[model samples]
Target: MTNDSPKPDDDAVRARVIEAADRLYYAYGVQAIGMDTLRTEAGVSLKRLYRLFPSKESILEQVLLHRHDMWNGLVERAIEGGEPRERLLAIYDMLARWFDEDDFRGCVFINCFGELGTTTPRVAEIVRTHKAGFQARLAELVAEAGGPQSLAPQLAILAEGAQTTAAIAGTNDAARQARQAAEVLIDAALGPATGTAQTRTSTTVTTARPAFRSRR
Candidate 1:
């Protein structure tokens, strides 16, 4: 009893499902998209799709996790090497580029939390994990820059605020403002970089704030 039917590659099918899910989920809220639409968009048979992801909940979870990897990878690449202080500024610089993307939406976790956090405990946990990971990366950078780990949360606030404001206002200048504000915080915590700490007095500790401009 050999029935000849081409079986779909699991890896290929899974990638397609994730790709379609990412586009649709980000464009429309997760709840609004149905399995039929996903199957059609992914161009996979219903059985195959089911085999890859048993339910919409499974697909949504995978999609969020996939995006977390991608988003974090981009940030890591942006801050890969350079002055620790400059790496801090580069966080906002990277955001400016992301904001300019045609498909730019606010932070994916933030959007997901708003839509599903109350109803879905899994979704809430995913969002919390992503946010914690984000802040942890910031903490690493801050510590390397000779700033206290305590400044990481404050910097994360500025970054999140800038991201939200940019999404609403449709401008990247928010990142620039955030970067400028970050400079003040970093200087306050780390003191002057070029000179000795003894050279810095209480009145001269703060550096001159410059007009913010988008670099990338």
Candidate 2:
């Protein structure tokens, strides 16, 4: 006699592996972790793991996709109910929260790019796409706030620079410093704030709480 039970679907199994791989990759770096370790961490058979992700590159691709979703969600939450200028500044607020996480290491895309970008074209493309998406988002926010188009890239640079600085310096102060610089840039581009923008800036600068876990 054979006992029958429903097995988890491929999507569920794939998600589990991606999640486990994400944790290991972020903690140990992608090049350092091997398939056997992933099998143990994911609690799936080696054969099954190979079946789900034919190669390590395949798994890394899925991991980056998952991280993209998380990054988008974080930005959306940070800018949720604010006016255009407030929304622009809110990006830094979100960064401040992320920097404060105990496990924060830095931007995962940047990290992966440094590790495999030169040799791995696929990995390089993914990292570029993620960064481009962020720049586009900042452009939209700047336009909405009636600021010059040039201001968006400047703001993006600050955010990107802050991530690297905070990670290397082992301090969360980078975010606050970036936010302050952003205020000056925004004012320069769009002129002085007349209404609630001033109030929002002061409040957001002082009252950031932990928003999400850093995947990297």
Candidate 3:
């Protein structure tokens, strides 16, 4: 006689593990969290967890992949239904909202890179791929906006720097500051012929720096 019982959904179990790992790894460095903690956090039996992911590294890899999908979706939603210029600026708008979140930590890729990139080749490669993907997306946006390809890297740098600065400074002001600088860069790239009079005027004014305070 064969006993029939419903088996757990592998996909759902895998997603739970990845989601739990993402949160745990983000809050605590990946190396600090062990498989036992992950299993508990995921609310999965150790046997099931091991069945889904043989090792912590495997779980981390899935988490990063999930994060990549999330990040891409976020950018797509932020830039949707906007003109090319608005789409470009919308990136900063998205950043501002993200930075204001109570649980806001730095970029997961950057954080993970700092933690594991040196010892783990795969983590480093995933980070590099994620960044390159963003830069490529920016290049497409710049091309659509009639800005030179060179402008995309500059904008990407500003966005990257803003993320680091916001994380370190513990303030969302970096987004506004980066957005101001981006406006200048965008106007210069598009030149006076294409730039709006308002943007042209704004570029001439000096932007005041925000005062720094230690979050610790």
Best by lDDT: 2
lDDT of 1 by residue, 125-193 (tens): 878877887887787777666678889999999999998899899989999999999889888998756
Displacement of residue 172 (Cα, Å) in model 2 is: 0.9
Off by over 4 Å in 1: 1-8, 193-216
Q: Model 3 clash pairs?
A: none
Per-residue lDDT over 111-173 for candidate 3, one digit per residue giving the tens place of the 0 to 100 score: 999999999888888888888888888888887777899999999999999999999999989
**Candidate 1 has which clashing residue pairs, if any?**
none
User: Tens-digit lDDT track for model 2 on 23-100?
Assistant: 999988999999999999988899878877778988898888888889988887888776777888999999999989
lDDT scores in order? 0.78, 0.83, 0.81
Badly placed stretches (over 4 Å) of model 2 are 1-8, 196-216
